[model samples]
Target: MLATTPKPPYYAVIFTSIRTSYDKEYIETAKKMEHLASLQEGYLGHESAREEVGITVSYWKDLESIKHWKSQSDHLLAQQKGRDKWYAAFKTRICLVERDYGFEREEQT
Candidate 1:
């Protein structure tokens, strides 16, 4: 499902990665990070997908929130694990969302 974000002028942290391999530890850590992120201040929402390459875009209210999330203790551990074992390579981009629009089909009963 797509993330339901607030009005524009927010921020998006786009994390794109190439995985070295998948493991139980990696899956668990990913889920933990997602949960931890949701509990943070200024966290709007996030959408993620993984195939040959993985992409996770998390929305934030401001850049400070993004910085806090990055320095979070557990998240710091996860980052090290990713570098040591999980990710072959990764790129993270932070963008200011100036404007946004989308459409979702209504479900019929």
Candidate 2:
């Protein structure tokens, strides 16, 4: 499902990663982080996809919100775990979404 974001000029944290063979704890941590993010201030919404590579994009109200999320203690731990156990490699990018448009087909009766 697409994330329901507010109007443009928001920040998006794009986390792209290649995972390791370790799967047990990683899935739990990922879900935990998503839940924790939902409880944070300035958190707009998030969407994620996984295949050979995984990508998670989280929307925020501002750069400050992004920074705060990074500094969050639980989030910090999750990051460390990602480095040590989950991800073989990863890149994070923050972008300002100045404009966005999309189309969803209506269900036919």
Candidate 3:
């Protein structure tokens, strides 16, 4: 189960993707990136999953943090690889959440 983040004004960036049939070291790189992201300053919380495709949602304290993460050198390479190889298509959406709360079946969205 995914854990709830603290009360906010927070940035929620959602990444949803469909993977290509080609395979490489994606799982390894993904784990490494997750580790790196968790250690990043302003990283609040994250949730992710994979099946026929994948979805990852990462929370940040502010836009600056999100920008820093986006521009990180290693992550930039990964983004390029994603565009070139692993992902056939993807979509990202950023949302601002204020005073959020939730529970199963009846999430306080």
Of models 1 and 3, which has the larger lDDT?
Answer: 1
What is candidate 2's lDDT per residue for 1-109, written digit by digit as tens?
A: 9999999989999999999998877888888999999998999999999999999999999999999999999999999988888889999999999999999999999
Give stretches of model 1 more than 4 Å off: 22-24
Name the top lDDT candidate.
1
Model 2 vs. true fold: TM: 0.97
Q: Model 1 Cα RMSD, Å?
A: 0.9
Deviating ranges (above 4 Å) for candidate 2: none
- The lDDT for every candidate, in the order shown, is 0.96, 0.94, 0.88
Quality of model 3 by C-alpha lDDT: 0.88
Candidate 2 residue-wise lDDT at 7: 90
TM-score of each: 0.97, 0.97, 0.88
For candidate 2, list the clashing residue pairs, or say none. none
